[model samples]
Target: MPPDLAIAHDFPLASCNTFGIDARARCYVRIASVAELAAALADPRLAGMPRLLLGGGSNIVLTGDFDGVVLHMAIMGREVLGEEGPDGKFTLVRAAAGENWHALVQWTLAQGLGGLENMSLIPGTVGAAPIQNIGAYGVELKDVLHSVTVYELATGRLRSMAASACRFGYRDSVFKHQDGKGLVIVDVTFALPTAWRANLGYAELAQAVAGAGLGAPGPADISEIVVAIRRRKLPDPALIGNAGSFFKNPVVSKTRCAELLAAFPALVHHAQRDGSEKLAAGWLIDQCGWKGRKLGAAGVYPKQALVLVNNGGATGAEVLALARAITDDVRQRYGVTLEPEPVFV
Candidate 1:
């Protein structure tokens, strides 16, 4: 072990993860710097042990105790790297992986940066954002991402990767794949537009802004509205044990979408730029009568059918069972397989 590295044994992880599953890590370490991370990884005592790189724990479901090492990223910092792009049209800002994601959004807004306003109040750390390509309202991380600094575990060296190299997609990135298994994000950089425009691409957001009587809404206005909307729709992980939305909105071919529309006239869907259609997973779960329904201690959130909650003392197995049941029901009824958003551990 490195001189500065402190490893704890049998660490309780109920509070680490948003789902609050009572799982334990055989060994755990809080990594506050890249040097410390590299040193710990190089230590021979921990060699060949499976590792879990944990961030805000907002996007994972622990099924049982992990019999390996848990690297809890705690690196922190944020700064303005000044302007970039053609004729200096964008402001480049960077943040460490351990920083709270929502806090970073607020900080950027405080600095008069506007591009991140549409994604306000998302949970998780900055490092986890790129891995999941976190998005909300009408904005995604990829839209403003400049690049990411990562510590390659295999070589014990640092590398800066461009957004394109990350291969971002709807709720996905390279970090989720086998090729990215050895990479650990240390920080992220974003290019915020100098001339900002409010993104009201989502109807609910546009209606809320209009209803608020803001004839000309600013970035702050959009951010406040998005925060309010999320507060009203999503359950706070502190009060309720949940990992936000449980499933991704299934995308289907235009022909398939048309067929489903003909069979179910009231089906909720949004057209994708790729000529496919994205169906609302929440609406599907609700239509299947899973909202507010429970199996053991696991249940669907009453306000949002997309969220699955641990009502009280719910085991991870119970949550998995509930998810499977919901998926099976939705598939049986609509012929669409619902893919879960959270990583199952």
Candidate 2:
């Protein structure tokens, strides 16, 4: 190891993950810069060890003690990089990997940017945003992402990948795949529109805007409304340990959705551009009677059926057990297999 590099052994990770599972990492290091990350990865002592690149830890579930190194990304910075495009119709902004995702949204709004408003209050760091292609209300990270700068672990080379290269999907990106294993995100750049318009596409958000009586709402207004809605629907990780929405809204073909809808009239679903229907995972779990229910120390959040919470001193095993029960019930009742949103380590 380099003389300047600091590494801790047997580090407790309960506080690092939102699920609050009392797991420990065999080795841990806080990486603050690209150079530091390179050095740490190149260190012979750390060679051949399994690596976990952790960001805000909001989108993960630690199943047990990690047997390898945990590289906690702490790189931080954010700034407006000025306007771009031939017509200068877009304003570009950049934030380092470890910058709090919600803080970045607010910062952009403060600078009069509007594209990120609908995703307000989404937890996790900027780097994790791309990995999950985090979305909320009516907006997704892919909509505003311009490019991402990453350090390739295998080659020890830095490269800038455009949005097209990220291969974003619903609640997914390239970073979640095998090809993305050693590519550590350093920073992300977004291209916000100069001619901005409020995206009130989501029915609930649109209704909220109407209820708020805003005839002409700006980015901040939409953001405030989104934050309010999330506060009411989701539990705060600080107050109640949770990894936000626990399941991805299952997508079904239009025919399948119609069949299910006919069988169950009260089904909550949204139509996708590709003609599929996105069924609400929360509603499915609620229908399965898991809401506010507990198994051991893990429970489904009372306010949001989609959220699985650590009631108190919950083990990762307990959380997984509760999640499995809920998944099984939903699958049995609805004939749809619900997939967990958080990465399990």
Candidate 3:
């Protein structure tokens, strides 16, 4: 027992992960401070073992037991760094890694911050945002993200990275790279505009706001619309045990999109700026007959084909199996490969 290592053995992890898989960690430690993280990393007992940095556990599926140390990020705080820019139009806010993401969004709204409104009701923690570059509606985290602070486990140093250095992509960032291994995100800083503008570009979001009779929707109004749309589309993890969208919208070349569009005139797709086309994964899954389908206790959500839910007591392996079946079917039928959005642990 090292001075810094408050270790717990055989820690139950069913509740930590949103998928509700009953996995256990061989050793677990909840870190609330830099000193605690540093001490635990230095402990000889954990020196050569594998380590998993867990945040809200919203974006992972624990297929089986983890054989190493689970570093549960519990670091928490939020602060306004400043409200200054050229003519004072920007507000800089910082939140610790372990802060609940949706709670942070609500707090920002309460404080009159406007950038994160489009992403309201998203699950996970602040630290996990950068890794996945979480996005919803028409706005992505990279749109307002300024920088992130990470504790490097490999070198035992803390470093800050700008948004560009994050290498953000569709549901990806530098943290997902091998070069970023052992780096634990500690906090995230956002540069939101003091002068707010509603992002109502996404079709469903735009229509929802309009349907509410809001001719000129503000940030708060837009947030409400987004929340309402998400509630209708996604199942609550508490009640249904889902990790939101199960698959990423697969991007294809313009030629491929054209070919598919010719075959199926009703194919749903969005063109990317890069001349690529992002096909609707949910529609593809639905077309492949996976919507509301089940294998064992794992099943596709009835309303959203993109969601895989634990009907009741579904294991990670069972969920993966269901996912694989859908993936294979979608590829076989549509010639498009569906990639899972959640991390398979």
Name the candidate that leads on TM-score. Answer: 1
Model 3 lDDT, full chain set:
0.91
- In candidate 3, which residue ranges exceed 4 Å CA deviation? 1-4
- List ranges where model 1 is wrong by over 4 Å: 1-3
- The weakest ten consecutive residues by lDDT in model 3 span 1-10
Off by over 4 Å in 2: 1-3
Better of 1 and 3 by TM-score: 1
Tens digits of per-residue lDDT for model 2, 1-345: 444679899999988998888999999989998888988888787888899989989999998999999999999999999999988989999999999999999999888888999999888999899999999877889999999999987798999999999999999889889998778899999999999999988899999999999999999999999999999989899988999999999999999999999999999999999999999999999998989999998999988899999999998889888888988998999999999999888
> What's the TM for model 3?
0.97
C-alpha lDDT score of every prediction, in listed order: 0.94, 0.92, 0.91
Best by lDDT: 1
Model 1 C-alpha lDDT per residue in residues 69-101, reported as the tens digit of each score: 999999999999999879899999999999999
Q: How close is every model to the real structure, measured as TM-score?
A: 0.98, 0.98, 0.97
Error of 2 at 144 (Å): 0.3
Candidate 2 global TM-score:
0.98
